[model samples]
Target: MAFDWSVEQIAAAPSITPPTLHKHYFRERKPRAEVRFRVEAKLFTVLMTETEARNVSTIDKYVKHFERHDACVPKSA
Candidate 1:
């Protein structure tokens, strides 16, 4: 599954800042339960509306995948 939403867009739906989402994306820190729930809720809503399919498990899979990946740092030129 793929989403066209950017970090900013995803964060906007949950009222989270882009930097916070970036931190999560890069595995800088684990997201708090409240933040994680909000993001999951947003994803659930969008996926249900767009595909008319229930995808909570799929969302969880991707979230866990990111958390398990090696930490990333932004590259500088």
Candidate 2:
């Protein structure tokens, strides 16, 4: 979904410093695994609170896009 949160708000949710998030996540640097998890968790929390069908779909799209090229780390055998 199109979030109403500003960069400051988004950064706040994941406990990331605004400047770091802007330079990393917003500026196209791939976030570290921990940062990615926190951000995705925040988005998932938002998705859980959404009730509209269309908005849920939109949020799903955002999650997928965020996860692009970043598969789950494989378990050690």
Candidate 3:
């Protein structure tokens, strides 16, 4: 994944593991500007075994629900 290298780089710089780096910066446990950038830039990855995948899935589900709702609602003229 594209973020793997970035994560590794970040981890190396901080002397931490990639997963820990992800937990602190990439996970949606807290709202962060960098997280939003990752989402917008498609720089994040979802691993099936990790909690990040579940978090990402939750965000995706909400986004899809809003998209459906927007499609069903009429726009104001």
Best by lDDT: 2
Clashing residue pairs found in predicted model 3: none
The C-alpha lDDT values of all candidates are: 0.58, 0.62, 0.54
Worst 10 residues of 1 by lDDT: 68-77
Tens-digit lDDT track for model 2 on 33-69?
5556767788777776673445767777767875653
Q: Where is model 1 more than 4 Å wrong at Cα?
A: 1-31, 53-77
lDDT of 1 by residue, 6-74 (tens): 567778977999888777656533444445566668865766665556566776676665555324312
Residue-level lDDT for 14 in candidate 3: 64
Backbone clashes in model 1, listed as residue pairs: none
- Give all TM-scores, in the order shown: 0.30, 0.38, 0.29
lDDT of 3 by residue, 17-65 (tens): 9888777866543343454456545422333333554676756665676
Alpha-carbon deviation at 25 in model 2, angstroms: 13
- lDDT for model 3, on a 0 to 1 scale? 0.54
Q: Give the TM-score of candidate 3.
A: 0.29
> Local error of candidate 2 at 17, Å?
16
